[model samples]
Target chain A: MSLLEVRNLKHKFRDGTEALRGVSFKVNSGDFIILAGKNGSGKTVLIRHLNGLYIPSEGEIFFEGKPIHKQIKWVRQNIGMVFQDADSQIVSQTVWNDTAFGPENLRLPKADIEKRVSNALLAVGMMELKDHSPHNLSGGEKRKLAIAGILAMDPRIIILDEPFTNLDYTGIIDILGQIVKLHKSGHTIICVTHEIEKVLYHSNRLIIMDRGLIAEDTLPEKGIFNTHKYGITPPMEEREGIEIVRDMTWLK
Target chain B: MAEITVFHFQAGNTLIYRLNTKLKLLLLLIYSFSIYQLSLKGVLFLSAFIFIAVSGTLTKPAGLIRQMKGFIFILILIVAASMTSVTGDPLFTGLPFPTREGLLSGMLAGWRFVMIIILGLIFTTTTRPNQIHAAVGEILKPFPLVNESAIAARMSLTIMFIPILMDMLNEIREARKARYIEGSRNPVKNISTITVPLISGVILRAGETSMAMESRLYSGALPGTKQAVQRKEYLLFAACLVPVVPAFLL
Candidate 1:
């Protein structure tokens, strides 16, 4: 069974705008997916549903063969989401407190929460800054704290929405390295970004959405060239004419 | 309050940092209440003692006091307002400037205010916001008709957002400067030009924050944290009042 299965998911805003028309996909364990599309392409809407952040107006989301809503708490705990804007996602004053938010809300024991928070901070290389105010952190550090907050919940699958937005080149590289490390450590990653050139190589598969529907879902190299047709500037053109998927990274 | 970093938590391993958050909060409330009852000498002695005593734990006292420049201006205003009154005996012949009584009274009031804020700074600086939230929830659990956890969560977020909003306002001002739109001499026009963007930004941020909260499984209830006031915590609490109580009685 797939780790996550979405069938005919549709969402309409209260103002009569259809954000997602009918989207379907399956995420198996250990899949590093890059969900890419142009503006208003339902990429965010789809990921939001997987995390139970939004309820689909129509269709069903099955997590490990169980309906999503029926086990929303489990699904939410399992599918962690790192939002596009890192600042808005910071819910506490201190880094340690922010990392503990999810676990505390989960009502885990005090000892368990502490251990999880420590482990998360350690994973992000932020153990030293754990007690510092979140307000004082650099942009890259804030992004890492957001990831650490999610990691504290110990989710099996992580979803990142526009993770590199507003980041400098160094910030982008810092976050991308963390994401790559998370994937290598066996956490499934579903990342959303128009800036695919930064992380397209790390992704094993690419799912392209357009006009509230999945336009293409295929291997990165096969579907990468077609990104321009869907309004995304192809990474191929941006990488100084580099066509190979393996070389599309800053880590190299 | 706009002096954002002054109130932000700083990492330290002093005695104050190790105190239980709930106990620190209770001590702050108790100490602030006692300040109104303190004589001017008592207030001065207590403030001096605490300032000196907690210097190690306060992390950045000099910076914290430096940001209080705006706050100190208000204190001076209070003193000036007190002096302008005619009820007290004048200190000098020059236009009934400062009355001896007014100066003493104003000094007491100002010191009281500073003592309260300093205590608050110590608490916020040493304690985590989430700890405050959890402590608040635990404290309010016995009250009727109260969503204790929700109130606690709001309190935490409000404290956290103050710095963010200040930063936003600063950025808005900078952007306006960059656009050369800050050339207007009218203060009202200057404020109005920036208010709209700041409000819109806050609204947008609120929407995003709610989404972030939901994604993290915030269900308006915090987990049960261990809040028992230990023996060491009580000793620390008593130790805080050691100098203050003697000053008060004297």
Candidate 2:
């Protein structure tokens, strides 16, 4: 069974802007899916609906065969979102407190909260600086801290919106390593990006959206070549004279 | 700017650091109120005691003095204004300045102001910002209409944002200098260039912050396990009240 199902979902803003028109998709458990599109292509709007941030103007969304609206909180608890701006996502003074913010909202016990926070920080290699101020961290460290905050919630699905935006090359590499690690740990990953070149090699499947509808949904090799038509840049290696080699032997 | 440590909390094992945050908050409030009621002598005694007590916990004693540089100018102004109006025996009997009553009154008033600032520095330096939120939440829990957790969270974010906004202002000032706009004589144009971007940045950041909080499922309060105040904390609270008792009697 699919973990999440969206059926002909549509959304319209109060200002008469049609952001999403009859979008539909299904996400299975343990799948690493990339949602790609250009600016104003409804990629953000579509993911926002999955977590109930925006109500659909029409159609339905289901989680585990049940309607999402009936259990909005549960949907939110299961789907953790890491926003683009790292600084804005930090709502607490210290790293530990900010990471614990999600679990605390769930009203867990003191011991459980501490264990989760410690484990999350350790997973992100931020255990030593747990007591430091989040504002003092570097750009790369801040992004990692944001991911750790979401990890503390222990969600089944992790969504990252423009994770590589405003990051240096080293920062981008750092975040990519973390994302790959999460995918390997059996968390269903859904990353939304207009620049798909950085993450294409890692994603198992690609879903392209254009003008509030799905443009193409297929395997990476086939669908990636069609991304530019919808305003997204395909990977550089796909072009002529750019040799690409990826070993699939390790998977067996 | 480098010397300034706004909202920086020093971790320590001192008596002040170990005390419950709620107790410290109450003590700070009581002490602040008592400052106005106490006589000049009492205020001086309290100021001296606080300085001696908090000195052990401060990492940089000089930083506190550096923060007082702006207030020093106001202190001098108060003394100058008081000297001219006060009537009393003049020093040297011929200089026409330095009246004994004015000198005494000015010193007293200046000391009171300094003492208030010092107490505030001590509170901020020793206590963590999150502890303040927890303390505030615990104190407001009894109010039927109040949502203590949400208010505390807002307070924490506001406090944390101060240093960030200050840094942004500094960056904008530098950017203006880089563009040679800093030397422009027109005040309106210079001010508008900086203010426009700063305000817009703040508004954008505020919207982002709200969305981030909502994504984390922050309804109002931090609903995790609560930490209870210990008996030792109650004892320390009583001990702090001892100093204020004399002010009440007087």
Candidate 3:
């Protein structure tokens, strides 16, 4: 069964600008789906609906056969989202406390919260810096901490929006490694980004949107066409003396 | 760049750092109360002692001193006001300045102000921001009308954002320099260039935080078990209250 299904979804802002125009899609369990588009293409607005952040003006979203709006809390718990700005997402002073904020909100037992926080920090290689304030961390580390905060919630589906923005090369690679790791661990992943070169090789499916509509939805290899037309970078398989290495075996 | 460190909590294994945040807060309250009752000479000596002692423990004592640079002008104004406002037997009759009473009163007031500032610095420097949040939350938990956890979380976020705001200001200044507008004489243009972007950035950040909080299922307050206070914490609290006894007696 599909974990999430959106049918004829449409959203219009209060200012009368249409953000999403009858977008429909299905996300199977444990699938890595990449949503690609240019600025104002409605990539973010669509994912915001998945977590019930925005109510649809038309159509509906279903989580395991039920409408998502009725179960906003459950949808949020199961579908975790890591936003673009790491600093804004981090609300707590220390790394551990920030990671614990989600579980604490769930009112989980202390022992369970502790275990989840430790595991999440360990997964992100941030256990050593758990005591440090999130403000002191580098930009990449802050992004990892944000992901760790989501992982502590033990969500089934993880969504990240423009995770590589304003990051150095090493920072980008670090976040990419975490995304790949999460995908391998059987978490259904949905990432939204205009920059496709770094993450395209790993994502199984690519969905492109343009002018508030889904332009294409297919496998990454077949979805490269008309990408530049929508202001997204098309996949570059090879360049002079340097090849795009899709197999990330070295990262393992 | 290093000035930013003065406002942040410094991690350490010292006795002051290890004390519970609630105990430190109580001690600060008692200390502030006691300062008013103490003799002027005693206040001066105590403030100097704390300034020297805390400076000795810090890795960069200069940072602590640098924090006082902005207050120097205010301190001078306060001293001048006290000196001019009070009249008595002058130290040198030929001079136009006030008498010994004004000098003593100004000195006492200045020392009191410095002492209170030092106490706050000591508290913030030694205690982590989360500890302060937890302490405030715990203290407010008994009140039925308040959402202690939510308030605590907001307080902690505010503390964390201070350094971030400072960093943003520095970045904006540097950007201005890069654009060759740092030396612009027009005050309106100079201020607008920074304030507009800073306010916009803050609003955007706040909106993003609200979305992130909603996605994390943060409704109003986070519910979590509190940490158990040790027997040693009681001892520390009692020790902190010792000075208050003398103040009451005097």
Candidate 4:
């Protein structure tokens, strides 16, 4: 049975702008889903609904067998979201305080909060910088700390919105490796991004949105995400490119 | 406030900054009490109070005094109001105004007001809001009732916003000044002219801040580690109260 499900979900902004128009999808436990789209495609809007940050104007979201609206806190406790901007996500002055934020909310005892915070920090390899202020952290470290903040929450499903937006080459590889480990740990994951070139291979399911609607939903395969469909320039079609090699390995 | 904030806080050192915020706030309480007692000494004590405030870490006391210049005008008006014909003696020796005793008392009241203002300026410049919030949580921790972390978080954010809001107000003023907004003194017209833009700016900034906070997952639980030194710090805070009590009692 699917661990999480969304059916015909829709959202409209207060300004009378329709941001998401009747999107639908589902993921069983341990499934890796990639939500893709162009700018203003409602990808972030859709992911936000999964975490109950925004309620759908239409359709239903189910966690396990329960509807999302009926169990908002329960849903949040299970689904962790990592937003695009690293700076905005951090709430504490110091890295230690930020990591402790999630567990502290849970009202756990001091020892438990300490252990979980330590474990979470260790997971992201940020234990060394625990005393450093979050503002002083490098871009990659900030992103990692943001992820660790969610990991401390111990969510069953982690949804990342444009997680690789500002990362350097090495940072991107490091984060991707962490995401793969998360998947291997039997946690369901959803990664949303417009640039599928980097993360297409890591996902078990691919969802594309266009103009507030789901454009495509499929498995990772060649000829998928073709720029020609969107009326944009196509790739070089270099068969020996790393992208091609990644796609081949991913599909296999 | 911005001028004072820029001058008082050094780039380094947490000795004054690290004490949990609530304790610093309690110190403000002690300072207020001390100032209230000093009112008996009249303007002489008030001048001494200002001297002590200037002696503190604030690098630009003159900037702070300048910020209070507008308030000083208001204080004069208050003193004048108290010295009206029904209440106090007038220095001008008018038929319908101030008794000799009332005029003297009004002057003393104004002096007390200045002392209070300077004390506030000192406290506001010296303390960070986060420490205060944490101190409040520490004080309440024994009960195990409220969510200390959330309270601390809100207090810190609110304190930080005061200076930010002041800057926003100044920006609005500058924008209005560009269009000659200060010509009218009529209250209703002035409010309508200034408030419409201010309210809209506040709403826009508030939405942006909230979105930024939510994106960061601010709704999550508080940190698990209560720094070991917080208890020792609390003792030091209690010690800070010792010096002020005797001063106030005298």
Scored by lDDT, the top model is 1
Instruction: Sort the candidates on TM-score, descending order.
Output: 1, 3, 2, 4
Superposition error at B30 for model 2 (Å): 2.4
Question: What ranges in model 2 sit over 4 Å off?
Answer: A237-252, B1-5, B8-10, B36-54, B60-121, B181-195, B224-250
What does DockQ give for each predicted structure? 0.53, 0.39, 0.47, 0.12
lDDT of each: 0.86, 0.81, 0.82, 0.68
- Cα lDDT for residue A193, candidate 4: 70
- Candidate 1 residue-wise lDDT, A144-249, digit = tens: 9999999999999999999998888899988999999999999999999988888888889999999999999999989877988999876653357655543567
Q: Which parts of model 4 have CA positions greater than 4 angstroms off?
A: A168-174, A223-225, A231-252, B1-22, B32-131, B137-153, B160-250
Best by TM-score: 1
Per-residue accuracy of model 4 over A1-252 as CA lDDT, tens digit each? 689888889898999999988888788898888787777888888888888888788899999989988877667768988878766676555577678766766667878878988998999888988866565566788889888988887899998888888888877877887778788887788988766657666777777778898777777664364545743223335565544423422122
Chain B alone, TM-score of each model? Answer: 0.80, 0.69, 0.68, 0.70
User: What is model 1's DockQ versus the real complex?
Assistant: 0.53
lDDT of 1 by residue, B70-152 (tens): 46767887777777763567887765667888887777777788888788778878877767877999899999999998898
Write one digit per residue (lDDT tens) for candidate 2, span B76-101.
88887888778888966777777898
What does the lDDT read for residue A102 in candidate 2? Answer: 87
lDDT of 3: 0.82
How would you encode candidate 3's per-residue C-alpha lDDT over A1-252 as one tens digit per residue? 799999999999999999999999999998899899999999999999999999999989999989999998888989999998888898876788899989888878889999999999999999999877677788899999999999999999999999999998898989999999999998999989887877877889999999889999999887766677889875555768774634422243
Candidate 3 lDDT over B7-62, as tens digits, reads: 56766776677777777777788778778777765565555556665775565666
Clashing pairs in 1: none
